[model samples]
Target chain A: MPDAPLISVRELSKQFRTFKRREGVWGAIQNLVKRDYRTVQAVDRVTFEIQRGDMVGYIGPNGAGKSTTIKMLTGILVPTGGEIHSNGYVPWKQRRQYVKTIGVVFGQRTQLWWDIAVIESFKLLRKIYDVPQRDYDERMELFNAVLKLNDYLHTPVRKLSLGERMRCDLAAALLHNPPILFLDEPTIGLDVVAKDHIRQFLKEINQRYRTTVLLTTHDLDDIEELCKRIMIIDHGRLLYDGPLALLKQKLLRTKQVKFVVKDSEQAARIAVLEKDGRKIEAVDHLTYRIVFDRAEVSTAELLRQILAEVEVRDLLIEDEPIEEIVKRIYAGEALKEVSA
Target chain B: MGPGVRKHVELLVAYAVQFIKVRLAYRADFLISTGASMLATAFAFGFLVVLFQKVPQLAGWKFEEVLFLYGFSLIPFGLFNVVSLNLYNFGNDFIIEGKFDRVLLRPVASLYQVIFEVFRIESLHEVVVGLLGVWLAASRLKLAWGPLEFVLLFFFALCGAVIYVAIFLMLTCVSFWVEDRVGVHPPVWNLIAFGRYPLSIYSGFVQFLLSWIIPFGFATYYPSVRLLGRPEFRVYAWLVPVVAATFLTMAIALWNRGVREYSSTGS
Candidate 1:
């Protein structure tokens, strides 16, 4: 009925068994005879579905299994349990064929040959993927225009800067025209201008190609600019999966309203309006702050009442920062805060 | 060839070309490595010559026969180094640095991709030196050559190379099980040392171990004995291809199992 989502993962899990060695020389000697191992559940029964042409952000704290999930989806790691069907193929089972349908960029590493020119690397990839000559040229032209890769096309990969290397990697990943793209911190160590260039290029590519993009990044700006759907995982479990706007509204309910009143009379009038769970705090003689739950009182109603009774000089409204909301979510407090 | 096979071959050629270009960028390093390999081969040849001067024969084998065995052994070992040296870097470059993910992410068989990623073209000089040594020995021995013998020699040399490659792959696959122990090239070097001389010189148990257990003897000693028309060793000379194929299959199986067990490094 839903056209079979492009990426369907159900109850996926991965467990890693790591040895716990003793600290001292005596303990090490004992370990030679008998070793102890501890099994860590890196990913635990996490489930989500991504429709075609959707751009989703996968975020979690460090060691929260974000990269582990990406690894399994890209067929680089096999899952310990559960099922993942990405573009009609089981990722780890049908790796060679499945990888042809998806493009992956790992920011920490370069896929290009370290000693070869950027163009030679692309040519090798074309042969490896068996992309036709015409399609390869077309993609190269498009990438050159968008990423401006021509400047460093003949330069060896090891000679390029971090931003230039990342740009080339992104272009290389998309040359095959895969239906899905997985970017793991594609802008990890980039400057402001470089970050903007990458973010814009990604936005354009998703729009023009209708590529389903699943991004894992610590940069909230990357998520805010590109991903409409957000999935947050913590402790190897999926904590939340929904629209970004809904997450912001659900987890962050309080809105701070700042009012600069013309006189003390106007400020006194604003104090009377602060009843029924609304909070009012004074900044200076003329400036006042009002904190209110959006669900309890509409900002427009409060503003209307204030404007009618007091002479306001200036006003500003601020919502909670997404960083703070995410922090709370990772802290295991968002659910309780939402219910209360 | 079918388009699929042609494409893979073309990819391998492209990788070779790129690697050559990279090597050329470091012209001094390239020259130094080639010179080092040449010197090493020359020294080994010198060692054999000096030993033969002291004694007319080693065990039951003559000087030319021993030289032929040593020369034959170098052909496969050199080829193995040229083609599969990257497999030796599995621990440091691939596992520790997490570069193996690049191999897995490609839309090709991981082993096939790695096999062709880098070509050690400097080792080709070893093959040249080996052919020269074999020609000199054969001319001195006045050996009778026939068409079937030539064919057997060709296949035996190929099977020998496959055995070396298989052994290297299997040894490197140990990295999948244990961390901090990927330097398998030294052990492989020691194993190849056993093949540079006739197995007849060793004790019976050592010969048995090399012939059956590890099969380095199949690559050199048995092939030399067959080429020389030695009667006793001729019976088992045909086992060269069999041993190569079996060991190669087992090595590939072990490598695939290692891939399945590969957890990858870091987050």
Candidate 2:
């Protein structure tokens, strides 16, 4: 049979009514006697789907309901309205069974036993998940091989480095061989090398086990490397969804070039080219930035043009950043803000 | 559900192993903590005995009998510290640090995970010495023991454990909403200090309240009386824990409701 979607959510929403607070103990004391409540629409009517083995990035700014959406998808939070069918089970409704088929990693925390060796934590999980002895042994061997857990299998989690702790956390979450993994900020606060290690491992896992991954991360590299599709939500609403390439195509076609020109006269002419404004950005004197839109002029062609106009020593080019795209999306832009 | 003991024993042992291993890693701190706990409990119980040595009976029970109440109270209270102390603090760290989301990812019961994470050995020494005190007091009383009577006493002592766990479980469940008991809960150590002794000494209304409402009698007095061969409390043998477990179950249901609230709002 062809692959059915591993996760299908329809119109899931969550709202929280919070108490309005003033200040001081007296104000808190006042809350005890008489109450006030304000309602916050945390996750507003979000719906999406993920097929088996598809790695997708679920991203939004702070308070954009990113974590809330992940929570609902993981069956930790029940939606105020809507239907969710995942891995042939209704998550929150059949929690005991549903959780068995998924793993989750929260980057800011450690899930292993704090004082015990890493392997001990895995063994405990083995019993908790009830994986048979042989299966557990095999998985343990494989995890140790891939994660290099042998180096710290006997070290208490508290002693592990931040990167090592995250590795152990990932290993602990997956010991059950769950079909899907939910990773929230799994590379937050890590050094670049550490982040790359984790991202590469995640990619391998997704390919090898066909683990459908739903990731919420601050690092765009995580999205760029692992997720084939991107979903952006803001103010509790789903803003965009589709292929990463499609997302990149719509908004920005130019790689911006920045350089320090040696000649002031050359800078003036560059500004003239820039004011043409079709897709050129050149500032005179100290810093000159030239916008090179791919649809307008080839990057090499723009470089040749800039070379003829000015004696350029140092320069830099930048692809349109995801953060910038998200900013515009949050600014309530329509689909027509194409930089190219 | 799935061979309860068969499943839980190994896991609980794992928890113990981890707890002890952690304690061992901090050997100096463990030694100091153990000493401090033993000293504090000894002084407190000793002071109580001195204050009441001149009296005929405290709350209508003799000195040794009061020790029985005190002794039985420790088992469940100690067991609770070992099992659920981290669960009491989970609401704070889980929310502030956002670790609750990680817990939701696991394939086990949330309640089980919460309770299993902590292993508090700080107060365990107190309970051990307290049990010894009970044995000494029992010997001085020169009470004749029958096979059936001894079994009943043992079973009744187990009920004290049940009652303490039941109350603790209920209170910890309340933490999801209130979050801080250091401010909100009443000064039970002073007001319900009568619970540490026999409940028979309190007024009729107070006795009824402690026995049925707060159910502290199940933790101390009811079991003490049954061991004392008091006919009035003989029926409490079966009733204490069965009745208290019902209350415990209600607390657990309330905990479920609280977990749902947290998972939804994520505040």
Candidate 3:
């Protein structure tokens, strides 16, 4: 396994034989005796890898196997088919040993011991992870500086504010200084300030410890703040995998060029309409909204035509956002394919 | 400081210290609750004495002999509660909150976390009374014991403890598929209450079912048979380990299969 990636997954898939309901109690009882079952392909053949210290966002819509992938990586669930090697250990086959190298923090759930003070929970974690006394103290000190856990160190986790609790959870996950961290929706349901605090702490830890991080979240802000690269999965397959800037470069190609003409004239709108039927929408009196598909016309060319066609009062050209492009990508609209 | 024992000892000591710290945090609550629990159980035993003063026998067993069984049962039952009771709702929590995720991540066996560190601080009071009852029963019965008897008694107690935990773990393993289990497996705890009584009185198939199938009979019944100096089924003594092993293996397999179901289904 020398020179092997820190995380490697190939042709991984999971199929569930879900039970079906019949009708009445008699039917239920009969079905119980010899039931009919239907199979669901939750995760189709999907593959990806993460080198050590990479913070990669894993994303997909609901039922598109986001959590399923995370579970297989964390050793919580064994995949029905495929290979996953993390830190030189098969996650499910050798779960006990593999888990020692990883820390997982699920934002919706907590790992801290309930009913105990945060400090006590930390001590228990120190024991569970078997970190030496010196190392535990050093990590606690680092966490104090990074996550600001001292504010609620003596308070039970149950009583903490959401932000404080997230900080504590972050500290708990890293006490062992695991070489890898898996964060499932770590910023979900958090206020902006709280999300920022967690995102900041994550960046600091990743930079300081060089730990590989696999983060899955719905908040795109998490991606912008923490990840340099992302793997976008949809329909149980990778749609895009690259640096964040490249996805945006495609969005930059397609910019919205709006024109404010001299007066409320149908001739100006007619002229604008003639240029592009589907892409142009009448915003108001002599105002037109034109969407330029980058492949059909460059932003510069679209602007030059709009300026030439209308006597303008005011005009604005805005760069299209990547979120909208990804939306288009997921909607099955063809993107100008990136050259490999 | 040897590599293997280091982690085991570290985790045990950590939990022990954490439990102590938790107990200290609510000293008044701990004292009041622990005192009430001790008193409540002692009153039950006291009530038994009152009833025995009048009738003198239950199903042909004398009051002192019944006390011997009752005392023996509670001490080990309390020990099981104090050590392994974390397993009672562990599987449900594992399935529901995905705490089992952490279980898979640690270097040590998840079984250790489920089986140990389960100290029921609320029931620490019961241990005191349980020991006291065992002493009182020994005095009342005037039982003779050499070093061999003491060792045998310890083994019997250990066997009871393992069997009790094994039953709960099987129930926990079932929670992977079972959503609401508080009703389905009330028998696990309810049976602990019945263990206080002798199996000899249950009569017919009830005795057979509890004896072999669930092995409630062997836990207390066989050891007491040895205590009575009666000829016993020698093969049944080995059966304790066999039953415990089989149930543990089955429960673990079910747990593995259940986790597989959860990953794909995400339910």
- Runs off by more than 4 Å, candidate 1: A22-33, A253-316, A336-340, B263-267
Instruction: Rank candidates by TM-score, best first.
Output: 1, 2, 3
Compared with the true structure, what per-residue lDDT tens digits does model 1 show for residues A247-306? 898888678788899877776677666667667788898998887777787989888877
Once fitted onto the true fold, the runs of candidate 3 whose alpha carbons sit more than 4 angstroms away are: A1-4, A21-31, A251-253, A256-318, B1-6, B23-36, B228-267
Question: Which is the leading candidate under TM-score?
Answer: 1
User: By DockQ, highest first, what's the ranking?
Assistant: 2, 3, 1
Which interface RMSD does candidate 2 score? 1.8
Model 2 segments more than 4 A misplaced: A257-289, A293-304, A307-319, A336-340, B87-91, B94-99, B179-186, B189-192
Interface RMSD, per-candidate values to 1 decimal: 2.2, 1.8, 2.5
Model 3 residue A167 CA deviation (Å) reads: 2.1
Say which candidate scores most in DockQ.
2
Model 1 DockQ vs. reference? 0.53
Give lDDT tens digits, candidate 3, residues B147-257: 876777767777777777767777776666654335345666776666677676777787787776666666676666566443545456657656766766776777667
State the DockQ of every prediction.
Answer: 0.53, 0.65, 0.53
Total backbone clashes of candidate 3, pairs 3 or more residues apart or in separate chains: 0
